[model samples]
Target: MKRALLLLIFAMPASLSLAACAAAQQTQAPSLAKRPIEGRFDVAPPAIVIPPPGPLPSDLAGRLARWEADAASGQQAFAAERDATAALVAAAAGAPVASERWVVAQQAISRLTAARAPLSGALADIDRLYIERTVDEAVDGLPDIYALRDRIAEMESAQDAILQALSAALPGQ
Candidate 1:
């Protein structure tokens, strides 16, 4: 009888200790707002000073002019494709989107892909010129160059959405 009583006395405190530990864990976690932020939240964009246009070498001047022309044409084509896609969507508003809509979407994707090349080429030219020329010499048309790059990227995203629709509409070949 004494041995059993002794065993219960020792086991009771150990079980009570475990219960207290579990109760401590059941307390609410620390609030997230109390924690300090670890890293930066806001970063400012770099400044790009566009200087006055300097006299250009004949070859570079001619190349820039050609690039401008190509960019203009590509922009026009992209606009046209966008309009066509919008028209197709408007026309099919009531009906379930048909395979014909997928065809139109595929065509739009192809046109967007074709139109991107020239703008990409123009951006590459700007990058090359930036590297080759002095800062002042390179800054004259920087805004226009960046605008074309941004426009192309936006169009690429639009094309990607259309491509996704096409794949979903006509899965596998």
Candidate 2:
């Protein structure tokens, strides 16, 4: 009776361990053949398209035109002033600061800076319009506004470069 009792206790645990090991082996084994995926894996997502913007409103269009014209005129005036200043700066390159030529050169530089006002004003107006359009959710006119702004900005940069070069050319700069 004692021997049978001890054998039952030890055999019970061994039988349970064997059962667990067999279940693990079955789950870990690879399948003999690969199955096809349930759905189309190569399918592409739909493309997104955005339509081009329409014309700007009449009022905004007129304002942009006026600003563009103003920038053009300003660019012309700046070019003239830049040339004059460049010549003056060249003449005063080695002159003393208190000499007449140096004084004239300084005055020319001042006028050159003043000549950029119209272009600056146009850029400022365009910036205001852009802000207003964005705030009002008027997106249709943004492209034109941006185009004008970019053009004016380039002109302004060129003027600035000229100004820098002229200033640097002056004596005791």
lDDT of each: 0.62, 0.89
Which 10 consecutive positions of candidate 2 have the poorest summed lDDT? 32-41
* Candidate 1 residue 101 C-alpha distance from true site, Å: 2.5
> Going through the candidates in order, what is the number of backbone clashes in each?
0, 0
The lDDT, on a scale of 0 to 1, for candidate 2 is 0.89
lDDT of 1 by residue, 67-89 (tens): 77776676667666666655554
lDDT for residue 155 in candidate 2, whole number 0-100: 93
Poorly placed runs, candidate 1 (over 4 Å): 1-54, 90-98, 134-173
RMSD over all Cα atoms, model 2: 6.4
Candidate 1 TM-score, C-alpha based: 0.42
lDDT, candidate 2, 1-173, per-residue tens? 99999999999999999999999987867776745774557678888887776678788888998999999989988888887788999999999987999999999999989988899999999999999888987888789889989999999998888888898889878
